[model samples]
Target: MQVSVKHSLPGRLRLLYDKNEYTSKQALLAQTLITVQEGILDTNCNTNIGSFLIYYDTHIVKENDVLNLFHALTGKYLEDPELLKNVDQIPETESIESVLIETLAIHYLKKWFLPLPVRTLLLWKSLLERCFHVLSKFAESKRLFSTELLDATAITVATLTGNKNTASQINLLLNIGEEIEEITKRNSYGNLAQSLLSADEPVQVVEGMDEKTVPASALKKDDVVVIRQSGLIPADGQILDGEGMVNQSSITGESIPIAKKAGDSVFAGTVLEEGEIYIKVVQTGKETKVQKIIDMIDNSQSLKAAAQQRSELIAEKVVPFNFLVTAATWFFTRNIVKTMATLMVDYSCAMKLSAPIAVLSAMKESATKGITVKGGKYLEEAALSKIVVLDKTGTLTYANPVLEKIYAMEGFTEDEVLTIAACLEEHYPHPLGRAVVRAASEKNLVHPENHTKVEYIVAHGIASTLNGKKVRIGSAHFIFEDEKIPCPESLAEIKKQSSLEGYSLLYLSHDGILVGVIAIGDPARPGTSEVIRELKNLGLEECIMITGDTEGAASKIAAECGIKKWISQALPEDKVKFIEDEKAKGHKVIMMGDGINDAPALSAATVGVAVEGCCSIAGETADIQLQKSGLDNLVTVRRLGMGLLEKINENNLTIVGVNSALMLLGIFGVISPQMAAILHNGTTVAISIRSMQPILK
Candidate 1:
């Protein structure tokens, strides 16, 4: 009953006499033992193989039963456990819940679980717990762990437990978890550690791909890798190829599955269900997605924040200098240990970790909400803006203005005007032509059945022939002066009104006579008013509209949107100057725009937010791009950015307060070096934890 790795005498005899030539069976037995030894295996690979071997060698699972489940999971090779290891972990393990949780925790929780410092601190605390667990499981005798390990683990574990229910609860739990709970309670590390521990299981927080992975050193032969739907495909191979749907949402952001066939490229860590894929290792397991994720987390500690770098430099200079003075104190008092304590307190981990982690966390937060802030610096700067300037066409209103109204001239019916208009505009591809064509369709007017040569007259309009009649659609200036068409009283009033309502007018003529007109306008989105109101409430100094349209049209649109000022008929160059003028007047302006014309203005503004579905040039020039072109994203950007600033400010205040008190104690020789190190590192860890708090709507 007491199974153990009893080597030497029985090993050769068992191998020779048993005649168990089945390599797969031996691999399974080896895998199960490894899992019991390691405490957890990937479970993705082992589950299928172990199940099959149990049924196969003993005839529990008939060949046909294996085929039925195998065919149901992967359409092919149900009898081959070697083939089952080939599918991505996520899709392969979607049917199993424990494997799903473990896979998610490995893929995302490890890579992007929390802010970097908070995650690092939590990881360290988790490491201590893991070490103890390892010792408890493997130790020959039940020797007690060191006080340092117990103290650190207990404090962090309690914080995690307390933080789960309430932040305040963490403080209450410290006394009961262990002897070191009191030590954690008196330090900042306890706060963040508790919060991380208290948080919902890391797997639950990981709703999407976060690139978590098993450590490279940990992957073993025949280890099962789990996959889930909506998970990233983490490995590359065709080991166990089962038929099932894979949600490639994590990798491609796609909603479809890749049908698993033999020799298909199976990515690591993808979620799988309704099919089973077992892979037998083509690529080395060390190069897996899980390994890469673990590698990134392990290496993240070396990625010094800007503040951390500065603190390190300060420590190098000041700590050495402080230690030199401590040497003199040691020389007088003959206490070497006391001098070592002075050196210990000089590390300043909290000051090093806080500010940068706050900034990075804010950037990560913005990305989650569909805004890609280019860098941490921009997030910091956006929080201080006072003015918001908007571009007229695509930013404030829809870029494709619809045909709002069509006015016919004397002797021309509205149908007559549209039929003729659609005919002439059919061959042209300008915004005006497209709008007119769309309107004609809505009115059930057939576009010209036949058309002649089409010509685009710059600064004028389009001209073409239909039914052997020369048709021209242009501005009134072109038609009246060149073609001698009269601009009637009705036509003049139509032009005036179009200009006042942000519409660009196009004139229609046939055989030297003005026949009709079409008025096109860029209408604001339905939710634009709410978005603008929210921005104003969030402390925007003023919202202004700038456009190349006529003053009347700009003013009218501005008034409707509740904007106070309008700059009309402004060219691209004028927009840049306007941004400079706003800055001169002491305003930090955020320009929201689209189109190539808005590029210069976008580049000039303090923060340029491009509405999604805009011109390629505008998207390229913008600092932030909305996923859906809407004013709602704009509101989200401002609110989330402000919340980020609040986090930074709070972290800064906490660091200052803790450091000041500690420094005050250090001057009095009351604070030991080890306590100082813990305090500094703990404070940094605490600030990182604070940054992870959810922002409000």
Candidate 2:
């Protein structure tokens, strides 16, 4: 139980334990370390090195405290002689090969040791039970000759005619198919769920003005918590105090970090990229927004597209016709082989299996491309999307705006103007504000905290008091019209030049007079125009740009991106209305946006595409999420959708053509019932495999 300090930092410490002492109780020691009352943020055990890494909040707990706790826990473990024995009793995960071997051994023992009569009875009982189950399903659903019914009929005929081998073969193939389907589904759901799970590290919660570290699961609604820079928010909550930039990209599909101050809400699973804040928990556990998203993703298969639903319905309806075909064959040919052949060559098998396989395969492909398509229905919608609505900022344009120029009025020097602007702008997390602060940093300009607490006016500017003088920085509309600040006529030429050059303007004023004008430029993303052209080539009828920027700025960006139509000074509602109008006109809309303001429009579109790193709300509302912040993958998704449809059609045609040929061969006595069943089922399995193949290439 003895330990020594391996590494120590301000809020982190690592200790190495003796491998001979705690050889198998690393997990037990890890559990004990986390239970320490001192604010230990996280504990990680490495049995190989016989060490533990501890991260704690320096504000609440010190390095000495952690060392003392580790010593105490080790002493407790040494005092309890039975602890190691108890730890050894915990089960380890079984290997897949081991599980498979065990299953095969059990099966072999039952099959080889049993008496012939008993084996026959056991096999017949299993076959009859399966047959009756299928029959019961058919009776309840009123669908005849489905895959289940076809399977049951084939096995029942084999058993009745004393062809036990044929019955056994049919049952084995059915079980294999079911296993493949179940594994495929489990893998798909697991990938998505794992992607959305919150971090496993402990979070620091505020208890009566003092910080305490606890596991995220221990958090409850109304509890206050602290989120530091680069830490994941453990639960959905509202900010109580302080300010920070939160990256809700995992939830929102937008890559931009949003500025959150007091009274603003933040969700679990999102990371705090900069600054820190105290949050009052609003939701926790399964009730969190991320959990709701996971639940939606889990149930996404239920929201099937019209085509998928129709395919299923047609598969079911074709069941009765399959029975009729078998009956007709038996009556005319007077051949039991032909009747069984017709039953084996069921249309429902390929019809039901291939569609889902194709969809799931496409989903897997999309995931590899960093895109997550919620359901097959959204892919279908994307395939037919004609009108593409794009949000300007953080969508087509780069989220990181660069400071191009600054025009200072007569009384203020450029450095003085920039320093003051940076001082106020540093308080918020807006992209433009961050640009100004970044520009100041690059120039090695030092801007002390010279202003009072800044008040951010959403969609406007920031207001504060600097040296007892009124200071304001925001849009031209906010300064010139709302604040009644008069811009000097001498600066008109600078403003005009900036607008002509496609630069976004930010006006800075002090004491009711315009002091400076800052020009910010956000370049179009790399290959943006080429991607737009490619989208057009791929049958996108229209690509429009919508933004809250001025007409001149919007026009310049639209021209650069090869988009002919654009709407300037658009609000959240305007984007929503544009999508709604397109839908009303019978256009399947693909709305791509990356902001909290873009959520409503995303929801209204036929398929909402959220870019990588977008806000959490946008991700939840978006039908498709692009893990990479680019338009190239959008093209990939479109092609994938078309390929899925083509694959489904090809599978249908092959199933029909091959089965008909097999049925005719059976009728002429060229093929036996066993051969016909093998061919029919083999073709179904082959087509299912083909459907799962990559669609891109």
Candidate 3:
């Protein structure tokens, strides 16, 4: 249940085997072939190796005649006990294991040499003679004909003219070997063994604690823990109080100086670039967004689409096709040698080898580019999507509002109001808090140094003591009424202007006087309109806006982004329904958002795209996650998805189209089975190459 390889080898193996090609008849045929081969080789251990060695002077027996004689003796030895009894009736025998190994070696040689038509005919003719010569030396009834010699004889006669089946079989065998080798390299024993033997998932149990191993997960809420230079912040929390420069680059994308102090929230995974600070822990374990993202990615395989589903169906069909081809050939030719050649020419090998490999490789490449596709199905779905829906906040606007203007009440100046508010809010982490601080910094106002105990009201504002006066910075509702701060004429005018401009207002108060107000709002992302223009050029329709913001704000943002359709004041569920409704109308919509509120909608879309730095649920539910949380990723993903689809289409055309054509031509009497086999095999090589075309940059 843990999904670890060491913990679930049998389950993992079952999953892996189930994913490979399967058809009832093909399964039965492969099982039957393996069973028959194992039995025959076991019985012929004493006789076949001796016959096989007679043709070779050295230890290595490279001739095809010797290999065919070995297969004939082995097959006959197992099926006809009379032949074995006669061989025993002759004389002293050689070592059984050595002869058994040599017989296996001969089978291996036959499999190896059967696919090369240039040399196969010569080897086939020579091997048929050797097999007859060895059997002729025995009693008449005890003699068994070589299946290889018979099939080769059929090929020799059937290919009097230039037919394709003979060449096709040889080509199919060559392609199969190469495909199997490549697949083996990808799903290698080394990879499986390494995954199985990896160190156990780093557990945070106190039992595993040691001096050298500082258990970061041991941290708890509100606990002050010191971070060494370059060490990571073990958990999410605010600095109780410290003086240090920290690398906030991992979290805030700020590569420059970020001073740490009391009340500054520090997230886990952020390094202490220079000085150290003690921080409190807020969230951990599954509560952390990172863990949830991992869980989401692990579970994404179930959401496959039509393309992958069709490919799976095709693979399943190939198994039945393989068995039928082999059975039909066996019935007509009445030869085991001809049957395997038919089986060897199946397109299943290439189909099974390339389909998932191409998808997984693309996923890996996308991840390196900072995007994480949950599974192949989503990649397929994304490739076909036409409509893209975007969330206004965080997706197209800054997560934190930037300070644009300040309005003062009757007797207060903007600087006086902003300075007092910034001093009180300097220790807070909310977007509004940062906005006020930035405003003060821009004016070069020296924040009051002697600040007393500061405390925050969630979803509201900050309260602190400055110069022995109660200072409060928050929403209008929080600063008025009981506080008796009248709405002055100037302040009221600023509120009206901000509302029309789509800005949220933050009230600032000092010592019971309504000083002034700070205006904060989501600002248009830099170059956002240009990105939309590019998307339009790339065949994207008008961007649609979905948001929880006020109607005015939503409308403003939509216009800025060049979107014609917009929805406002909607909850998370509303967003999901909007996307579903579009889908119901036959629109293939790609929903884009980077918040927990967008998770459900993202999951509901034909394909969900999440930018990097989004909430865990958003990232997990999304079909495609961009590495950079920018519109640029949308362009990149679209191109990549299109390229992938084109490759798949090309493969389908080359492999399925060409092979079917050759088969029909052969069946109509214009070509032989040998020639058909050659053409069929060539199609597989072409398909694999076509499937591996690189995605556009």
Candidate 4:
């Protein structure tokens, strides 16, 4: 238990243990050390060198406290073997393979070396236990031909007939198959969980203006951390000083790199794709937004699709019929052997196992391609979606909009209009707001807090007061129609000029009079038309674009994107109503958007997809989050879902056809009970493996 401190800091420590002393006990010691207090954030153990590192909150517990606890625990463990009882064994997941190998070898040896009476007794005992286990499941819910029932029945019949060898063989095969199934399921789920919880490499933290490398767990709120190009942001915080193009696909599922400068907010798990930034941490640990989203996804099983639930119910319901058929075979044929064979080939094994395997595998495959589908049900909806409703600004086009021009009315200078507009818009994160703020920054225009707190009206505009004068900025519909603001006849020509440019216009007003018009140019994303065509070819019957932009701008973008149906100046409620109307007409709706205004429609659709670089709210509201920036990945999701359905259907056919053939052969005396047991179990295992294969390939 001798240890030496390899490194030490205020909130962190790394220790190297005497390799010869600890040997295989490094993991046990590491686990025991963390239980010393709740201040320990994380611990890592390298058993090979008998070294461990601990990260803790110095504000809650000091370094001496942890070191003292570790020493005391080491002393106690060395003095008493009783204290090490529970920690002596390796974890089950770490040793399952070895355990299976050893068990198989021992079973083989006993089968050959043991006497017939002893073997028969052992086999009978195991068979009885298995049958009891199956019967116990009735307390929960009855499933007549469950794999447990099939296995128990097969082994019981063989043991009663004094065919001890056949009974042992059946039990061994079933046990091995079950182990393999458990391992496969765990591996698939583990792959995804690991991906989400994967730790980043040590990050550089600026402590009192001195930079040093430390584990991400060492980060605390308000700590200034320096992130370089391609470095993952260690925690959620605001940019204090520096600029970068941040790729937040990991957190928000957006693939486009956002231009982040001083005063802008960033999230943990996002990467600085280019440049560097020093962020003042606002939230760390499990309090970060990404962690919360991951927690939600982890617990989203309740959202399972109707089809998956039906498949499970059907699997269970067919079990009773399997038992009935076996009884009929025994009654009519008057052969115990045939009855045993019939029991061996029930549909429940493949039916129950293959469907979930196909679904989980498809989910894993989608994750690899940068799409996160919360559950299998959403995949079902994605495959069946007929009508796709798209939001124009961030979903169909890039969110990075440029301020093209600004026209000021009489009594207001262009700079004055932009300064006030920027001050108001900076409080919101919409594309238009960002465009105005960026323009002001580029022009070196400083707009201080010359206004009261801004009020954001979703799908409308920003309302605030500047120098006791009411000011508003938003779409033409919001300012002129909703707010009842009047556009002066003198500015008619200016409005006409802005409209002809095919750019989106935001109206700015002062005291109920339109004083300025800001033109924002956000071009349709490249390949939009091609993606729309591909979606149609893939069976999307209707494609529509809904936007709050002017009719001219919406029409121009829709035409460019090959969309024939376009709704202009539509409010958030209008988009929701559109989806509801489509659903009422028997069409399954898929909504794709990346803005706060799109949240309602996204939640109302059959399948909601949030594109990469979307706002946090949009990403959270959507069912499927696409990590890629473009629409190309949308097709991948559609195909993946369809592929899963196809694979499940194929597996069903295979299970039914193979089991039916085996039953016929057994009843006709063409195959023995032993052969039936082997073939049926082997087929189930093979199909289960096939179900886990990549759907796209």
Candidate 5:
């Protein structure tokens, strides 16, 4: 791909490339990759003019960096040809103006150019298609009620009155309205699909005994990719070797960093918080699983909100009344023109269309802000839930934990215990692990990995052989009760002091003998206290904390966040039971957490919100997935969901108020049937376009 610099500024650059050669999908893929890079503030790739524009911070990025990046991308794409498999997710949609003009022009051109009989047959053929929907629906219920049946009645009345011209105009307007609605909806989905675009980059792969760097897209099934600290895991794969603490907040919605090791599965979009691991690729691009889920959500009617479902039911119920109005006009006045006027106003049409239109528009607006709502149903739940349950670890505190103190047993110096602990913890880069490793590094302690074949039992301690002696390190339960290692008498004093100080403990035992203890302290994340206040201001009735941590530690974090209710030392089952109990009491509970343990509770909550750094299980189980970090977006989502419901209500009121006036004017001889048809369809089209407009900034 040959390129030339079109222009350049201190912090901006534009390059010209051949659109005819690269294709729009390739250009978009290139843009997605560039946008995610640090220091590149913005990117605008206008495929129309083949110009790629980039804005950056002059201090952070250089002009040569931009050019070199693109040069490297060219070879990377060649290595993995299917990198663009999900790039073309959004289909091109025609503007409403184009659809309306084309529909009207096509409808009239046939009437003018074709012979009388031919035009008549074509018009009836089009009208019959509308009649077919009505007949098909009526077949199921054995009744003449539906929005489609009402549409057919208007066309039939126009023809019976010997007004073929009115009939043709009516059909043409319906066709135009339908086309505009279809285009509007497709545009909504297109906007959302843009948010799911793949941001590909190069990654390190292990071959033989050495590691090689390759494009993320170049990875194939069974490829062993080495992910280091702060590197994004680029594919869904199982860890083949090594261990690390993974922060999945950006992808799986985990609240804190999770420990990953050999045999553990890793997902793409999760950051390697600490350590390094070799992963065997299971899937790439996240399109096979995610794209299909999005498809299922789009087509599944069961996922629609209750209000949307009610609007459909209301639309169908009113169709029968539309028939009654036409019948009364004919029976009392014996006026064919008045009957036709009532026929022109199909009251149910606008009601049904506007509801889903509002939902889709709100959903599209949310995607821009990095909120992935699975369905409209959850949005509604966000508004109604008052009792909010928050997970402590990653939600209230940062993943970065600090090693405040180390209490070595008698005869062992603090330095000796720290060195030994860091050696074992270096493999797992989770919050606590990262803290231990960092502490050792800051002290210039040289700790080498001399242990052989360490085993990590999840939710327990790690066991391995060190210098021909068995060693274990983890929670007190893992070291004492689980391993049956007796604790030293002095350790009881340390435990009492640590618990009162609200510090989490890590116990280390060497060769069945208790050796030392380490204390880890956590600070509240910036603005967490304020976010809790904001949630309360937004009508959250009560906020509570549930955790597996000791009561003292959980209480300290909960107090920092102003949470008064809590249940500590709870297992995964306990969290679920808490949510179910709240729901049973008729309280709408919103649960937020990010961990494997949180998955069941998330499922049992009235609305499950998976915060940043979540595991795959929690992300998949939660009702909503926050793509970005922090609780600010949780506030944004709650507002957005509430806004959607309000918009739908306002739209319903407008549809009813405006169309009812049009119907009255038509029946009372104030407007002709044709004029009523024009106004009625115009109102429907207006509301639909309004619904597609932004609900949030």
Candidate 6:
């Protein structure tokens, strides 16, 4: 690669380079590297033009120095960390095992291949590195005691006492332990990153009544694509035709596949597990929903649980204690070897390494089981939450409603009432509205907009004027109570029977009088009852259902799902108040919801779980998103939460117990400094490796 200056200024220079000399990726890398240098303030690179513009401080960097910098990238300099320092998000290509093996190879090669005098001198470099780290840490915090300080003291003492072999082994063990713990924690991210979309894959699109294949980059907004069985969805798009079961593990972290049909949404990176679907592309590439999931994983460090932070704080605080033990042992026994043993077994190192590895590893495992935990704290919260509150519409009744019965009053006909309802409802997105409209459409009832302006009362009903009289349609609370429409005595029995059957009733009225009743069958998701029972088996304290359905319908569904407690005719605010009330009573609540109305309550609960969707509704943006179509993933999340919390506690206890035993054995003079160091680091590596295992069966 070659670089040259095409134009120059005191503080700004326009540099030119051969386009053939470097790839576009290398251009961006060069730009990133140069921007972080002391004098270079900013840089803009146009790989297409084979040139870059640099803005630098002339007093700090000269034109000659800038040209010399570019010349240094001629060969074997691209992977150098020194060149990329302070530049963020650069991909790491080096493997942890390779680093460990290389370090080990270097350590042993000097001892076996080199003569004693030369090998002994090489050991000082390792001692100096340890001593520098110890001093630098103290310089930053003004603290005399730390894990690094302990290691440095022990290593320095061993070397000064003519124990070069012991000094080298101690540093090698510490280096190996650090590498192992780092890889253990990082393995989760590596697995998660594997699910990122394969951007270069081709997709099939509809063109002029025929299907044709095109690159994913060729797809754009509103373009229709056909996905077959076992095909990967290339973009975030809505289904326009056909149906299939989409495996959303890549996006929602759940392995369960969801059935999709026309008018349903599908996301990029999700596989069409079964059947097929024709999708109208909404967004593709980096803008897809799966990309967002990848972004979330990339930033999960910021979402560390309270438990993880506390363990880390305790780890730091315990450092001074280790030093105190070492100082006390040396003063009383007057034995250098005994002093080195206590210093070798560090409590802080084990706790600090294992806690985050446990939390992150558990999170990674949960994603594979189809639950995306937004924060480690939420998993901790899930482990402790006693109550589970579920939203009704999408939470309990998983799909759109179907119009089951139309009861017309004496003055009107059934078709007339259905037409009026459908005309008004076709404009809204609610499930019941869709049911009414769909029923009307199937019967070939063309009910266009004949009413005046429609007024929507959220969680209540719709109101409008039909030829000058007031027409109302919604829940029993909306029409009969809020709108002051009187219920006919003759229809009381029918209303009671409808509710008992678990069918949501939509009441219609005109001019303050009852006109008709529409019973909508919003069935419970398959195996919902079994899921609730299983949750109870998992030690859930209580399960509560909240909905805007009539009392009879709410009661029947609750009973069928084995949910003992329920709140009917609930508005959005009522949901929020219920969660707050539960919190006030000292109970931790897990709120599972699906709609936009459920946002507040989801946030109010101890841990918000979004189900059957990617975000809030999990894809709807909840703390935990169940990407699958049912509530069974709830069982998975609960198991994972409890498992993670338990594992973390178990690891902490094991670390303390093992390290304490090591310190005792050392104080008794049963082990050398090398043996003490080996046992201590071995415990840390073992605990970290165990923490990285799946917490769930």
Q: Which candidate ranks first by lDDT, i.e. highest?
A: 5
The local lDDT score (0 to 100) that residue 48 gets in candidate 4 is 46
TM-score-sorted candidate list, best first: 5, 2, 4, 6, 3, 1
Model 4 lDDT tens row, 41-144: 77666554567788889888888877775776555554444334323222222334665797799889988899988888888788878978888886567544
TM-score, prediction 2:
0.70
Worst 10 residues of 6 by lDDT: 84-93
Alpha-carbon lDDT of model 2: 0.75
Q: Could you tell me every candidate's TM-score relative to the true structure? A: 0.47, 0.70, 0.56, 0.67, 0.81, 0.64
Please give the distance, in angstroms, between residue 686's alpha carbon in candidate 6 and its true position after superposition: 1.2
Would you list the C-alpha lDDT of every candidate in the order shown? 0.53, 0.75, 0.57, 0.76, 0.78, 0.76
Error of 2 at 455 (Å): 18
> Candidate 1: global Cα-lDDT?
0.53
> 1-697 in candidate 6: lDDT tens per residue?
4677889989989998887766655765566556656687767676557788888899899988887777776546555443333122222233666878898998787778899878777778777887898889889988777898888889888888877777888888888887777776666565554322222345788987899655565577888898987788877889988866665643432223455788988776567755668888887543344546556775666777777787788888988888888889989999888988888998889888888888777777776676677768888888788899987766787544679899999598999899989988876535577789999999999886768999876557789998888889998888877888877897888867886666667888877788889998866788999999988888889999997667777887787788889998888789899999989999999998766667778878999887764332334447787756788888888888888878877887898899999998888899988899989988888888787898877
Which is the better candidate, 2 or 4, if ranked by lDDT? Answer: 4
**Which sections of candidate 2 miss by over 4 Å?**
1-124, 162-220, 227-236, 243-276, 284-294, 324-338, 408-487, 492-516, 668-671
| Number of colliding residue pairs in each model | 68, 9, 18, 5, 7, 14
Write candidate 3's Cα lDDT for 415-512 as tens digits. 88788778877776455667788878877999757768997664456777778888788877778854566676667667777776678777877777
By TM-score, the best candidate is: 5
Give the C-alpha miss distance for residue 604 in model 3, angstroms: 2.5
Model 1 residue 558 distance off true place after TM-score fit, in angstroms? 0.8
lDDT of 5 by residue, 89-172 (tens): 444455777777888888778877989888778768877888888788778878778767766877887777677888888888
Worst 10 residues of 4 by lDDT: 85-94
Q: Whole-model lDDT for model 3 versus the true structure?
A: 0.57
C-alpha displacement of 317 in model 4, angstroms? 2.4
Tell me the deviation in Å of residue 87 in model 1. 23
lDDT of 6 at 240: 87
The worst-scoring run of ten residues by lDDT in candidate 1 lies at: 196-205
